[model samples]
Target: MSPTKLLIGQIFIVFAIMVLGVWAATQWCAAMLGYQPQLGQAWLETWVFAIYRPWQIFAWWYHYDAYAPEVFDKAGTLAGASGFLGCAAAIAGSLWRARQASHVTTYGSARWAGLREIRKAGLLRPVGKFLGTYAGRYLRHDGPEHVMAFAPTRSGEGVGLVVPTLLSWTGSAVIHDVKGENWQLTAGGRARFSHALLFNPTDRRSAHCNPLLEVRRGADEVRDVQNIADVLVDPVPATDTSGYAGLSDSIDRHTWQLLKGVALSTLLGVGTEISFGDERSDLVRALRQSAQQNGARAGDQIVGRSLDIPPTLEVRPGWPLRVLVHRDVVLRPWRQGGA
Candidate 1:
């Protein structure tokens, strides 16, 4: 039954018991006193006395005179005791019933979702993100729902969960395989389905992708260069560090400035000509001489076009510096000059 109905029923039963106990006690009092009072009069008096003169019921027991044979209201005392016992039992029963009902409600609502529910929700699928095994069947969530896993170290997060999903998943996935174990295990199988590439910074044989190459010449060129510079000069390391922690603030600022200048020049096709001599005229003279040499090389022949040169160029670390000239440019002089 509902809690409200159960509580109402308990209250009615308790009131009835209290009334019956008071009536029985009044009847016993009348018979002992040998007086027949009006109907309901004795009951009313007994209830009033029970409330106001409760001490009178047990007074005779505590202050009993052995020499006197005066009668006491023993029945009233028994009735009061029974009434208290009945109320206590009712309260205990109410608590027990409520506890039992709560347990039933909780157990009904907290059960795991069944196979039918899973299927209805579209979580049981063939090609999708893996959830777990249930009822000897593999469960997958094909819907666009976010999944997260939290597990301690040495647990089979990769082998048990990740590898299984990677092997089954046909869609594109970009995984950060720190130990390279995931690539080693699943690369062969996945290669058959899709083109897989591994990019490791420490590995020399890994694919090379220059971020600077992506910088284009446009209105947003400065913003793109700034973003790349921020990433390069960011002091926060992605993982733990061992030796040579980082550069100081001043040095980092200087490096950022240098990178920004070089990147802007390269992407914008503007070069800062550095002259070896101290005078500004020396730099102008060098440019004039270079132009005269280029004109002489053309030898009155109309040069239809000149190749565009990147204003700035980067030589990656651990590599020998070499000049990169356009194929259309004459290289006979440089070859003979041992340049």
Candidate 2:
């Protein structure tokens, strides 16, 4: 049954037991006093005694007349026993229902993703990122969603998931291999199709990438250099003022600003050689100067060629003989070609 209906039923049963106990005690009291029992009077007495005169029942039992019949005593005992049992049952049922309500069951509610579902999600693609193994088969995730793995230290995460995935996956991946095991195991296989580089700071063989090189050299040069400096000099947030945390944070910020300034200066100084100009007008002026120089060179070549030609040769018209000779030379090949 639903919890609501079950709770309502329990309450009704408890109330019924309580009323029955009161009625049994009232009946016994009426018998002892040799008076007829009245249900209305019993209910009125119950309400008054239960609320304002709650101690009356115990006081009556302690000061009851010894002349009371044995049957009356037995009825009173039965009433007390029934009331105790009813209260206990209510308390126990409430606790049991609360426990059941709060309890969570994993059975039939949660299940691992099956092969068909995985394949349908395109996680079984050869180029997909490896998630883990399911039922002795590798499971991959091809979607763009992020995946995170949580495992305790000394687990088989590297051997089982990382290495296997790196060996089979053809796409690019960034791995955080603390022990350098992934590089040793999968480096050769990956090198066949991709350029693999390890960036371990402690190791001399690791490839180095200068963060400042990534900073763009333009109007936003300072901002870009500051961003790289921020990443390079990240400090832990201060948790308390008792230790060097505040001092460290101050030093880090100072160092970051100093590094940013130095980086900006270095890039600005070096970039001048490659940078066309600082402003659009400067670039336009440089382009105009280049165009003028190219035009001057072309003009100089034309003028030189014109000056190199003999003036008398150009003034006389002897082109008919030259044209006749060229025509004869062209026709001589066709005349001599015939066998």
Candidate 3:
């Protein structure tokens, strides 16, 4: 199957498992209280809240009359639940087919050239993939001046939203499957290598759910979150006042720092994996820069953590900071001490 379809499938499976699990649980609870479900906003709210917390059910029940509760029959929650389940199933089915085509790890073979070229262009196809490490020649970080412009979906029928980054490697490759997973790079740090990969999280549009790639050496880590820059460029088209104003200048110092992590990760892919530490940032300074770079319409006045900056700012610009990733898989396992 194609890599794109496979990616859609994995995303579908992930969402389906979450949504269905919640739907089933909600159904059971409603049955106890003599209710089913509905095809209303309440159903969505209910499903979201239920999976997040048990107290949410009570919260929904309180406001049911105004939203979903008005439509749900106390003894007929099953119908609503069934409708919700059906949608989840349908989305899963659609994505299942798409996902089947996206898991291609190898891309240099003669047959993969055209597809690999499209991916190399760094253009995203709307609702896309998770982390697909093709380890191919198509992966390279082009400066904003060279990166292509791809339109994100205004709405979606497939996998919500996604960004596909290609990982270009010159040395080794290390991947952070960060669903709370840790990665480690030990020794071999001197090997100069770089890698680029695409990132597409289903909830990419949300304030949360940032699935990006970070390559860190010590506390100094660089990251690439494609959306951050695009959103900044959204307000108006490029004006001629400044060279950087154009889409051509979309990549900035922040972006350069972000890619450091990408280079470190792929460098360690073939060697060993070991722990390094995470970077700490000055929220005040980072907020100022992030907001400024993002066209002054960024996060709340309340400053927050961002992976785009380096850990410590006291050091000179050339130094690196490293962190520990607990789940580093160095040496790829030994087989009976054989060579």
Candidate 4:
């Protein structure tokens, strides 16, 4: 199947499993309660009524006369105030937990934490994998080198969102099968590579899912600089100031995912994945300038052929960034026993 369709299928499967499990549990609980006299209804009430009762009450609140309080008594007033405080506390507690959950791992062990911890605490596992797998053409992160780096772009343009991806050589060219199992090619040797499936907040209008590719050195770690300015640029419409306002939902719904461990968008608002280094702001400016230089039309993609600035402009020699801008550029799938 095509990559896009396969992505949609995986998403459907995840939700289907979750929903079916919830329904089955509900049925089993109801059946047990109907039969056994010893098992009190308190357990079922806690699970069912405590969870769904709020919504049920809200739905019927206006339809019932019980909400019309004819009493201005001190007791009634105190009860109402307490209820409001309870609701407020619930909301505040939820927001606090969400902030804590989305906390990015900056230093130490969490940076290299295993998949189990990552899938649970990272909170970006589901959609990140969906988008990465699709954009990377079924490749997966081979190791535990996932990094939640802050993108250098402007806030609404795609920065401020904790972008997570495998960014090291040990985290290079990992491939996966149709069942989403990780596997490396038996023949090829390992290479120093970086891969990130980034979504732009500005390009929310366009459907281009940007996949950034940076190639610095091979497995041998030899660095031969190419004509390409170590940066790849795909241009947007020169006139459009809001160059790809990426999926607004992705940013807005991120906090919720932190709390619930669920991803919102699996298909919508995917933008072009351009490969660049830590010099993202500079690279974006250069790509725009290149677009202007090429006389690119509204929908044209202006690809960078060489460095947009001087060689000495911004040099990070030890960790040089490489980029492949074209749609067809494909690197070898990371293999086993190659370094």
Model 4: ten consecutive residues of lowest lDDT = 261-270
Q: Could you tell me which residue pairs clash in candidate 2?
A: none
Q: What would the per-residue lDDT of candidate 3 be over residues 240-261, giving only the tens digit for each residue?
A: 4354344432223343333333
32-87: candidate 4 lDDT, tens digit per residue? 33423332233334443422211222222234325333321332344345455545
lDDT per model vs. reference:
0.62, 0.64, 0.40, 0.34
Task: Give candidate 4's error at residue 195 in angstroms.
Answer: 32
**Which residue pairs clash in candidate 1?**
none
Name the 10 consecutive residues with the lowest summed lDDT in model 1: 302-311
lDDT of 2: 0.64
TM-score of each: 0.41, 0.37, 0.17, 0.13
User: Tens digits of per-residue lDDT for model 1 on 1-339?
Assistant: 566677777888787777666656545554554543322233234522422222333443344423223444466565786689678869976886778586465335576787789889887678777777888878777677778878898788777678998898999999988999999999889999997788998988577887777776577776777788777874332121354432321122234545666665443333222322334587677875675555444422221111122123332356444678777776465466576
Candidate 2 residue spans exceeding 4 A from truth? 1-108, 113-127, 131-136, 150-155, 211-231, 234-253, 260-339
* lDDT of candidate 2 over 1-339, digit per residue (tens): 457866998899888887777666755555455443321233244532422122234434555546554645775787788799799879988987887664334353455766788778886666666777667766777677987788898788778777887988888888787878889999999999999999988899899988877777668777887788777775444433366443322222245656665665555445543444545687666865675556556545544554454322121233232323534344444556585
Evaluated with TM-score, which candidate comes out highest?
A: 1
